[model samples]
Target: MSSSRILLASRCATEDEISELVFKLQALLPERRRQHLRRVSRDEVLEEVCSYIRKLHKQVDDTSERISQLLASADLDADVLRSLLQQ
Candidate 1:
């Protein structure tokens, strides 16, 4: 049940690729052995999760920058808002 002891050879995968690979791999397992399979599959799972997390982090950063850009372009500064409200 515990998967921490699992170790796997290092491999490279992009997040989308990892997701597809995990889905395909898990789907190939028998229903009765999926639990054990996960344990046995720890190496691949860990690799995929790591890749996905990194991709998510990059997306989060990019989204934050985009929001800042939008706010700047929209002239949403507090001082500008205050001036507009006064008029």
Candidate 2:
């Protein structure tokens, strides 16, 4: 095969792979998001993913802050705190 045909074939394969991965990512999203994504572009799907990640990070930070506050207020001994943390 000519170089141009080989390049075209490689490009098509790459595109197909990207499409499959995007579909998998969409499937991982919440049902509401997936429904919205049905007619949206790839860029929109990516934006949704970014938004979801930010929300998760916020949740983690909030939870960590709450845990620190609780630990500080309790003022338990080092051994007790270490055992509690292990659990």
Candidate 3:
């Protein structure tokens, strides 16, 4: 399915709706290739993407905390400000 249709399918889509969409999309693929699509359902794909997003957000939060700690310990002189900019 196109990204537009996928976006429309987001969040509010019922499990039956997603299954129907996936079924239609699968029909366009060659018989042997259909198995690959079946390996991950639409819900599975959504969950995986959400999991990755959470991981990335956590990394951002951790990095920001470390930077705050670095800034807190540093002297607020002109040279130190320049060093922070370089970082």
Candidate 4:
């Protein structure tokens, strides 16, 4: 399918918030119908894939940062508990 069509399918998907456009498109049509679908250039597909990867990477980085902060807080709490026990 064309890049624009895939992107639109992603936006239009109502069954799952995290559904991939390609999967949605595949589920929408039979193989025969799919064969007639317009094909997107490799460059356009590559650009879309790269953009998605970057978005996923950012999400992972943000989650990692939040986990680090939680761990640091837990360490501080542990220290406070240790001091109280010593007293």
Put down candidate 2 lDDT per residue, 15-84, tens digits, no spaces: 6787787788888889998998997777888889889889989999999999999998997999999998
- The models' CA-based lDDT, in order, is 0.63, 0.86, 0.71, 0.61
Please list the Cα RMSD from the true structure of every candidate, rounded to 1 decimal place.
12.8, 4.0, 10.5, 15.1
Count clashing pairs, candidate 1: 0
Q: Residue 86 CA error for candidate 4 (Å)?
A: 30
Lowest summed lDDT window (length 10), candidate 4: 18-27
TM-score, one value per model: 0.42, 0.72, 0.50, 0.42
Better of 1 and 3 by lDDT: 3
Of the candidates shown, which would achieve the greatest lDDT relative to the real structure? 2
Model 1, 1-87: lDDT tens per residue? 234323221345655676677767665555654455564454765565566567779999999898677767785779976775589
Model 4 stretches with alpha carbons more than 4 Å out: 1-38, 76-87
lDDT, model 3, position 18 = 70
**Candidate 2 regions off by >4 Å?**
1-13, 77-87
Report residue 53 deviation for candidate 1 (angstroms): 0.3
After superposing candidate 1 on the true structure, give the runs of residues whose Cα lies further than 4 Å from its correct spot. 1-40, 77-87
Backbone clashes in model 3, listed as residue pairs: none
Model 4, 1-87: lDDT tens digits are: 889878887787543543455545444554654454437543444455566567779999999898677666775677776775489
Residue 29 local lDDT, model 4: 52
